[model samples]
Target: MRTLVFLGLLAGFGFGQGPQATLPNLVPQVVSPPDFPPELAELEGLHDAGRYREVYEKALARKDAWGYVLASYAATNYARYQASDKERQDWFRRAADAAREAVKLAPGQKGTPSLNASVEAKAYFALGQALGRYVQYAGLFTQALLVNQIRSAFSKAIELAPDFPDPKIGMALWHAEGVARNICLIFGCRRDQVQVFLNAAEAQRSNSKRVILGYVDGGYANLLINDLKEAERGLTTALSLTPKTAEDYYEQERAKGLMEELKRRKGGSR
Candidate 1:
């Protein structure tokens, strides 16, 4: 899952302070889902190589649901790392559109085959991720609207695959962001709800959860809520995890960045 790009904006709000990080600031790698498609290995290879633009182009070339899904993923990455300020939102919009196309093509329910369910859930997740990034550039009213849609997409993804942790982490981020901004009362986000979703996600770590940045995301969310102890715990867990891929190493770097923030916050109060 992609990290929050809007977080840098929170620096002025007494959260997410420190060095600015972009969405694709972390190294890229491929994580194949169960029932991996044999034909898509080349595109996956491109993504794993961090050739995001080529991945997007070749993925959309296939013109299938899975193709669109990968296209969305690649486009999101490209937007985060490569696009200029003026072009970033356009790429995110393209990503969201590709994800919508993927959902339209997949069209399945919770009880469907694992591959179908995974594809549909991924499409929803991709859509939510794109919207999440886009919200950073939107006005407050647009942000409210986008946040609701992000919640809806994430909730639907969870309903489809109860074990998938990405959407859960996304929901946790949503609640945390709302709490940090002190807008929970107006938006209906609760502090407790953050832990609820985060715990649910951590429970799946032994099963379906693979990305390490999600742990960084969890810690970052905790930091947003002023839960410094939990923030340290989450970042510590991320640091302790053995890294096997470029994504792992880069995510740990992110965790380390958060750890620095955690340390500064703790030390300054003394």
Candidate 2:
């Protein structure tokens, strides 16, 4: 599948390029916006209750940008957590397709203020996230195209809303994964920028589970670089957060798993 080439494309296209900043050692205190759409909030509640299939069905019924975006999140979570191996690929494809539709329906960011243009940012982020999950099982012939699409989606998301942290986190993960796979040897993956992106994201605190994921991804990036101290710090911060959604719970569990791995590595270094 020429994964090295794919990483090269991701770097050349400026996937992880963003503002540089230092992430504070503590999780930022933030609150969810009170003006959040009630209907979407209800779906998020259902998703938090772990009723992913229900949320997916209900969100899909709305047949709009917001609906499709939520549906994509639910679908991806269900596929990752509940779907059988045989079903995972199809579910991921469905998730990606739903997110793509959301992107199409979302208003363009041309004249819209970044904060007011969240729909397009969310839609593009979901599209990138879903395509990333799908690529794991996609055929080699399609994987290249999917990789490029994922990069484009996330890049557009960050461009549409520079303050949005999820896309920034996604970009950090892209660089971390490239470094983990030694793709930096091929394309100058710029592993240092991994922290740069994460730092920029952390500075924009939010109540969304995406912020928690930023920590998880940061821990993962540090883990990839064998920076155990920072890795443990990041994972610990992720674990300290209250899970506000099913995805948060899922990722915290992942954090725990990573912590165990970190411990093992630490012991091995003795």
**Any idea how many clashes model 1 has?**
0
User: Which stretches of candidate 2 lie above 4 Å from their native place?
Assistant: 1-36, 108-117, 185-188
lDDT value, residue 152 of candidate 1: 88
Model 1: per-residue lDDT, tens digit, 9-89? 332221121122333443443455531255676676566545778889889887778888889878876776556678877
lDDT of each: 0.72, 0.71
Clashing pairs in 2: none
Candidate 2 structure quality by residue, lDDT tens digits, 13-67: 2122111122223222222531125556777666655677887999999898888
Number of clashes found in candidate 2: 0
TM-scores, each model vs. reference = 0.81, 0.80
Model 2: what TM-score? 0.80
- Looking at model 2, residue 222 earns an lDDT score of 83
Each prediction's RMSD over C-alphas, in Å, is: 6.1, 7.6
